[model samples]
Target: MIVQHNIMALNSYNRLGTNNNAVQKNLEKLSSGYRINRAGDDAAGLAISEKMRAQITGLERAQLNAKDGISLVQTAEGALTEVHSMLNRLVELGVESANGIYQATDRDKIQAEVNQITEEIDRISKSTNFNGIKLLDGSLGSSTANVDGGSAITATQTDATQAQYVGANAVLNGVTFASLTKGDVLTVTVNTRINGTDSAQTFSLTYNPDKHTQLSDLQDALNAQIKEAFGADFKVTDNTQVLTFEAKEAGADKAIVSGMSWTVKNYNDSASGVVVATGSTSMTETKGVDAYTTVSGFDGGATALTKTSSSADVEKNTLTINGQKFVMVKDKDAAANVNKIDSGINVIVAKDLDQAAADIEKATGIKVAVDGNNLKVFAPKGAASGGAGLTLQVGDTADSFNKVTVSVDNMSSAGLGVNGLTVTDQGIAADSITRVKSAIEKVSVNRGRLGALQNRLEHTLNNLATTTENMTNAESRIRDTDMAQEMMAFTKNNVLVQAAQSMLAQANQQPQQVLQLLR
Candidate 1:
């Protein structure tokens, strides 16, 4: 009775449209098989999964990087192996040289080979590289130790006597002396002469002050004339009244006196026995008082004179700093012999003596030893005397270098000297090779650690894959529509739509009864 519009058909169409949309969504879910097809499907889950995906990818790549590091270390180790082989061969050559069987010529040939091997070492040090980074060359690394700190870094050379061979000059004055004059003879009348030793040579001298300007001046002139004549072989002595001349050289009998106005008494005698005027004096007592190399004579005993050599009055190497030369000692044991370094520097003591020694050598070209609580730095006896200037700095302390720490671990057994890879007849060369190998091993072990970390990453990746699968499945249950249930609903909705259309047609037909009333 209150039929205003076909509201039942309108309601049926609206319900069918809604059920169709649901069915279509279920079908899409079945086809795609993922809960989140886009950001609209699940916002928070998509964001978290994306982050996890990036981490998994980075971990995989990191593992590859670690593997590459291992390869580089292995390559360097292989090259070092070849160097070790060549070193062993050089050691064999050194042994052959030391046998004393080889002549000078054979040794020369061996030296040539040694030179070639040294060239090879230089070549390897320069040419070896990894990723454009040189590995065996000492130039590759920056010094971690700071030399400018408050601690003094020093180096010492070992041999003190090698300076003589290097043309070091002596402090020279104009004065010189003759070692001996041969003319005077005191006949041994009390001691009977042997069968063939009765011959002698004789000479005499009379000192006149009017003939020479001063006695001291005459003595200098006489000393120089004598030394120029006999070099270091002859000796002279004066007893204030008469001057005696003698020779210590075998079969030496005569001397010509120079720069003196004197007459000979008995110039002629048998030459079977000779006399020498060798004079001796205490050199230490005459230091700074008399000119060096002055000789005085005793009445009748063996006389000694200072043998003239460049070493007799040599000065120490002049070390200059800040435009001033530091006072140095010819011998390190003399009074106040230490070279006074003026600059203040911070000291970063290394963990052990060996490391400290190496640092000092690198910084100052001098080796150092830990003496009790102090450091004793010595130049290798004859190291050439030039060094990079040291700057006193206090800012940055070396964090990598440890301060004087002693542990009970075994020594590294590696060095560049007798025990190292430069193998003469000594095992030092082998020791250096061993140390290098050990270093290589340490790098290799570090690479192994990286490899282990890479393995862990791989395991994590696998776990992430399994977790991703499970999580995706769980999300699917929450967001996906079931294809079986949706298909049934779609089919039922289609049937209901057709049945509603039929019932609506029948209801509309009932409204056409006015035509039957007109008939």
Candidate 2:
């Protein structure tokens, strides 16, 4: 045996080192409670676990985002509840005023209350917020169609006209009353000016052929009835087989006749009445339009022109912009009609093209200017700030349905259709009633939408939680060490290390044996 070259000892020494290294590795796995403590231990497993960790973190954050979304929906819905209540109150007032029992003074008091409610509604819409973000100002998602800007339009009232006629008076007007028998009832509605505002009153007359066979008797009966009911002097005159009713006073403020209607009821056969000539008239009070200019470098710009007396001619006008259509209708408080587009854009009717351009700018963030009888609309310069609509990201992934967009519209009195409600007379009050009801419906719809979104977010949160739990479990399987199994491995490695040490000592002794032989 050569002292310098001891092959057996060398082999045993290498085995000892190998076993010692394995023992340390097993110790690490047990102490750390992870199958792969480092990349050197399991490179592929580390990569996979890290990916799972990222997904888990993302899911956690997404859940938080969903919670925030629910909070926002709740905030908006709460404000809308108040709006709903106000609309109900407005409807109540409207119905009361339409009964014609209240005088002009009483109606005015009711109108004041309505106006206050409207203003409050507008205030709530403008101020309602979640985390300082306006909720009901149509910033979420908005669409628009053909619409342009114009001056502020005022309210207009239609001219008075004779709507119906009955009795022997009908015969004088070349129409025969075939069923003017006993117990026949005739209803007459008179629209007149009272206290500088429009008012209406109705009178019912029961026909008794035995008591009212002569035309003179019929005229006297009608005169006495009119004087008592309306507190006004009026005479019905006949000229060449034609009948005309005129107020005794003569002047603009002399309770001029606005409209007249008559209806026959409780007749054996069909009652006959003739409608006199229809009257069409309107009065406008102008509020100047605000102007708007276009931002440079805007594509898809549009031009709008304002038309005079002819401008208010259209009962309803439609505008198509960016594949969206906006319908414009006359507003009592505006000089021209206005349209609220689904895209959060507003179209204002103006007296002229310049006024339209101005009004458009004031209403929409978009800028516009008159381009020869046409108003041009353009996007504002720089990124849309302040007025940019709401954007909600609901998922970690960039996919459809992961994002929700909503356009919260203005919820003010004007937006709710009660901005210019008037209760001066039965006709006007009746119109107000219809408008108030419509506002109530709008508020209901908005509330429903918000509630639905809240529910969807709740479901989203649950899904995220489940996904996180399952993924965490998968990650644990890949990364966590089974303590019992690791302990067994550690014990086996410990025994092998001791055995290798003992063998190492024996192998070193063999090298000493060579020295003994040399001695």
Candidate 3:
């Protein structure tokens, strides 16, 4: 009706533009084979999909890690198989030497073989390695000490408890240490003993998304802040994606990480690292160690120590030292509970407590139970093995619940207490056989532990496969395009696009017809 404002044509043009946009969106979804390619398509779905994708990736990597752990266990167990054979052979030689018919000269040859076999045992324990990591040594296994039953000739067993004076330590694995993002600010409150006085200090670090994107970036930055605030005696380390803090000086009440709290703006924001720890997260810190509370012997009895004194007649406490003939002298009011003497041999006393081989607990049964209230210490208890050092990360989570740890006992000749055994004499040779049998039991126990580790890993692999499949299925449902459905949508939108184009053309013509009014 009016030349100045072509209202009909404007309506067609607007409809055409809107229809074309729908067509473009349809093409994007169809060609890309994705239901939601951008945030505009489905913002909530995108976020959920991304988080699921990350979990899948982590689960996959965890499978590989579990595989590596199996390999390590296999290598250690296989080497132990050989050790088992050598130990059995040692027992055979010992029994042969024990025969009364065998003369001293013949027994010497047996002794020579025993020495070589023992040396070879030591060699295997020292040199056995898997990927440059020692397997049969005391390092990878839990620490065990020989619990002597009072006398040198008594039965000995392995005990795995230690005093909690190693260090104040803990791993804050609850937080996905990689997740700290830009504008994410966290404060660490540290409580420590300064000159035996309890002191508290707080330090905070802010994450800049522009700078820290790598896992190491987050760890290093946070660690630096912790170190600066915690001072020189403490050290922070990241192991297997775990943040561990330990004191360089070993003792009770050394350090305590009182609390850790964070404030994050976005889940991932600008940080390249995936944000895992979410929502006002905090870790409750506990003290790591305890002082000299109660000491129990290896045999579930009271602990005893033999002190060698310059003055022999110091109150005459008759305590036998390793079955060696020694006179025990009382130096104090304290006395041991168990009496293990032919007559009246009392346990030794101190003041006269000069000292012996600091035994590293080889000749003593020193049990230290931790009192959690006193100090911050992390004392790893020893086990049937000499040390438990290897930790297996079998799950995607960074917590103790998701880990499997194994103990590889030391299988060396000395470790089994056969290094000193001799096959040259009949009585001694018989004793050697007894000891070798004991050694065999130790190797068997070690192998059994490794076997358990392998089996557990196998089960873990099965679980991981199942979980990965399920998660992938869930993510696909939320993300992947339904091709048939998309096709139907595409067809409908394409038709609308064509219709809009034709209408737009007609709209232009309608404006032209208005000019014919001038004619």
Ranking by lDDT: 3, 2, 1
lDDT against the true structure, per candidate, is 0.35, 0.53, 0.54
Top candidate, metric TM-score: 3
* Candidate 2, superposed: residue stretches over 4 Å from native: 145-389, 515-519
- TM-score-superior candidate, 1 or 2: 2
Consecutive 10-residue window with the lowest summed lDDT within model 3: 287-296
Model 2 accuracy (lDDT, Cα): 0.53
TM-score of each: 0.37, 0.55, 0.57
lDDT of 1 at 426: 28
The sequence of per-residue lDDT tens digits that candidate 1 reaches over residues 278-374 is 3321111000111111111101111110111221111222211111112222232321222122111112233444454454444333344544433
Residue 145 alpha-carbon offset, candidate 3, angstroms: 1.1
Residue 258 Cα positional deviation in candidate 3, in Å, after optimal superposition: 47
lDDT of 2 by residue, 202-316 (tens): 4444544454235554445556665666555666775543345444653444333333222121222222221111121221111111211211111111122123122322222
In terms of lDDT, the best-performing candidate is 3
